[model samples]
Target: MSRIGRLWNSLANPDRIPKLFAIVLGAVILIGFLIPLDLNVDQLYPRPVPQEQVEENISTAPYARGGEVLESPGITRAQYPENSKSLGWINSYMSPLAIWVASTSPYFGTSIYSSPGGLIDEILYYTRGFDTILESTILMMAFVIASWLGVNFTMNRKKREAEAAADKSKDYYDPTLNKNKTYYYNNQNSNIKEEQD
Candidate 1:
């Protein structure tokens, strides 16, 4: 068989299949958390709500300038959907969840994760960093478990080999010719000798 065939045979073994699946799953999770998807902001982002709605929703005091409510200009502010806003700033690459965490989180009292073209800056860098850490941890655990299983298999194989060798040696050279025939061979032999003598 070819090298590829041998490799496939080993991988297809039932004992190794679970370990292979774990490694693949870990890699996929790591990639999913690391790689950011490219998406259009206009399609995903919600329109800004008027300040009037904001005041009404929060039940906060109305803005007053010169004792005139009209002076506030009815400030218009961007409204970010719950758990999603920072995804708009797709600088180079950024994960959707990381962007969401950064956008929802407060930075300089603004909803955006960063300033200057809304680039994915420190906010995404740090937030996503945690996911990378978790992925690495899982990968490490898989490696350790696989290594341990390999060591155990090797040890068991060696032990069985040693036992087989001992059995063959006993069959070829037995100290007592009939020892294998009975569990109490030595006692029975002594009793027979005593009765005869």
Candidate 2:
């Protein structure tokens, strides 16, 4: 057979093709991680919070400043330059959920975990990691399942078609002849021809 004919024959037999394909795909994902380039997203970033939005959210109270209520213009509230913001980020990875065991504030002794945004940011980061793993697992599983189902469906269809063809061949070979009735009719016809003679 030519190369094309050989390929066609192999394709006609698809029992292990899907399993082979799954192995290849898994290997590629495992080893084919390409480092991303061109990630300079800062060049396209529209300045952080826009001047008007920052101004609007700025402290409107009289004690904020004399003429300018905005200390840091165009900065987001998430990055509001408070005294604790830098300290909070430095201690984030350590016990990001709760930095201290005890608290002596008027807010009923709430621990470091009670600090706003500390716990939430850590949770979001780890949750994102878990989500990445889960999403990859689901995608690979889906690929395998879809390929297996498709191959099985094709095989069953081929089987049914083969059975139908065999049935058609059988019909052609057996042309509705009854053995006992044919023997009797043949003998009777010969006797009538002899009587006429």
Candidate 3:
């Protein structure tokens, strides 16, 4: 057969199914990592906390001495600068989640109340829990398949070695025998009988 045909046959072998599956899974993970995440801030946080309210609260706080508050404006998307393209893209997409988490977290003292640990806990336990479970299950199955294949290969090798050893022992020469032990014994018995007669 041709080289391509042989390669195809090898790849299609049932014994290699686990390896093929692992390769596919690895490719999927690679693709997922390469794809950029797109998140809309407006959709994630429909009602953001007003900047005026935050500033007012900070200004009137006991920490503010002589009722003086910092008047510097916060950084906007247009004003933000980044040197790396990949990092910039990641920051733009992930900033919404960060904003949502910070705004909803009880630690930040926002108007919206969230459970302890906030949005992060909710996403991990509720939204993304199934994906985590499936990933772990697939990993475990791959490990099991690899271990089973290794064990079977070792067992088969040992069995072949034992068979070879047995064959070698059977084929060895015997010092007490001539060409064949049975024939040598038969001929000797016949000669003894003839002499007795």
Candidate 4:
């Protein structure tokens, strides 16, 4: 048989399957929290160039230099925008889910280049929104999972306890029951005593 087949056979047992699933799921969740998303939000539009600089360049003309667009830094590279025309970078420390949620808000979602009204508006509704949403989702999911496991565990424990109690109540020839209990006689007229404890 193949190695995979052997592994599956071993783990497929009723006793081991749940443990295997829990271990694999826990590892995935841990890695997801550790990994960071690669989000460079500079693909939206041409880099902004100030009109004053363009005018200044025209006044101090160099005959040899052709009229070419000057390279300027994109707004998204900055941690925060000073004015209305910056797209700003999302926090690097945020989880992937949080980043996705924050960056995909209505204002930031449709267009990362467009102004989000103001800095507070951008931060509250757009950038930091991911963390809020992710936290709520985690809490909700945890509540649901905990309730499910709790119910199953409680029911299984009760069932096992009831079965044990029922087994104890059964009338068996337990030698520990009573030392002076009378035993039924055989057809051959022999008084056979019950086995000693």
Candidate 5:
């Protein structure tokens, strides 16, 4: 058969159903991470300062009293930056933070780059270090538990099968039949053989 036919048969097998489900679930999670969804910054950081209040405070501040304000604070929008895409969030916020750490940190300074490996390193070692560690530890513990359970299940099944086989063999044996068998005896003094039934 062809490779596709073999793969289809494997996927259809009951024993591989769980493994296939895990692969599909993992793929979905990977895709979700890779594809960034558009989100509102204001919704994420909802606390808003009034434009007038900010202007008054800046104008009254000692340094700003003499200097002119270059740009004025604009009106607060319910959702700021209309039609903003997901890339903006990464470029404006996450990338700068990651770049700063990659540049300044001695451990990551040399290896960190604008590549996928660098992004993974930044997440695993810097951004979400504790979370990554916890996730890995949890996955390890789950695997160990699953393996132990599987071993115990197979052992118990084998033990039960052996007991069943022993019981089946015992059903073929009869003590009454053995007792009724003819017995032959030799008499040494008389030099004669006797048979009893």
Candidate 6:
């Protein structure tokens, strides 16, 4: 069999069961994205507006209560939000979206009240906490990585200095190894010349 085919067979064996676990984990993440999970916001938190206020606004019939927009007789110029142009439609659409997100999903849902306006507040409030935590974690991780790099650099520098000290010279030779010396006997040169004659 081909090498690649053998590898495939090996991976398919029961011994490589960890691949199944990895597949399961990937599936869970995909499902989480498709079907949102519950957030841990109790009803007590962030304070629900008083029911009396709601009832009063309803009785008055002119003022809008947060999301609720009211239509009036002979008022053609009924100023409504661009998305919620009229009270009736605005109340109809936004209410359900907010309730669904807030009550069902991990997102804290739409903030009905905001400084400047409600929609801007909703955008900021729901996402602010996560953004803050993410930023903070990234900053902290960067600091840690930088510190680790500095320590490693210092250690490597010290090691090089120690090595340089040990290797003071590379052409190292023991003095005892050069004990033998050469001698020249030029005095015997005249005797060699007389024999040759």
Q: Which residue pairs of candidate 2 clash? A: 98-113
For model 3 the local lDDT of residue 60 reads 17
Candidate 1 per-residue lDDT over residues 26-80, each given as its tens digit: 9999989878888765642223445642444422212111111223222222234
Q: What overall lDDT goes with each candidate model? A: 0.47, 0.43, 0.47, 0.45, 0.45, 0.44
| lDDT (10s digit) by residue, model 4, range 1-197 | 68878687666556688998899999999999878877675643223344543444432111112221223222232233454343333212233553365455432223443332333333554546577788799999999999887776654656654554579666544332222332332322232222210
Model 3 gets an lDDT of 0.47
- Winner on TM-score between 2 and 6 is 6
Tens-place lDDT per residue, model 2, 10-46, is 5655565898789999988877676455656554212
lDDT of 5 by residue, 145-189 (tens): 998977766546566546555685555433222222212221341
Q: What total of clashing residue pairs does each candidate reach?
A: 1, 1, 0, 0, 0, 1
Worst lDDT run of 10 residues, candidate 2, spans 60-69
TM-score of 5: 0.27
TM-score of each: 0.24, 0.22, 0.27, 0.24, 0.27, 0.22
RMSD in order of candidates:
20.8, 21.5, 21.6, 19.5, 22.0, 24.9
Q: Itemize residue pairs with steric clashes in candidate 4.
A: none
- Shift in Å, residue 57, candidate 2: 23
- The best-first sequence of candidates by lDDT reads 3, 1, 4, 5, 6, 2
lDDT for model 6, please: 0.44
* Per-residue C-alpha lDDT of model 6 across residues 137-173, encoded as one tens digit per residue: 9999999999887766654656655554578574443
Cα shift from native, residue 185, model 1 (Å): 34
- RMSD of candidate 4 to true structure, Å: 19.5
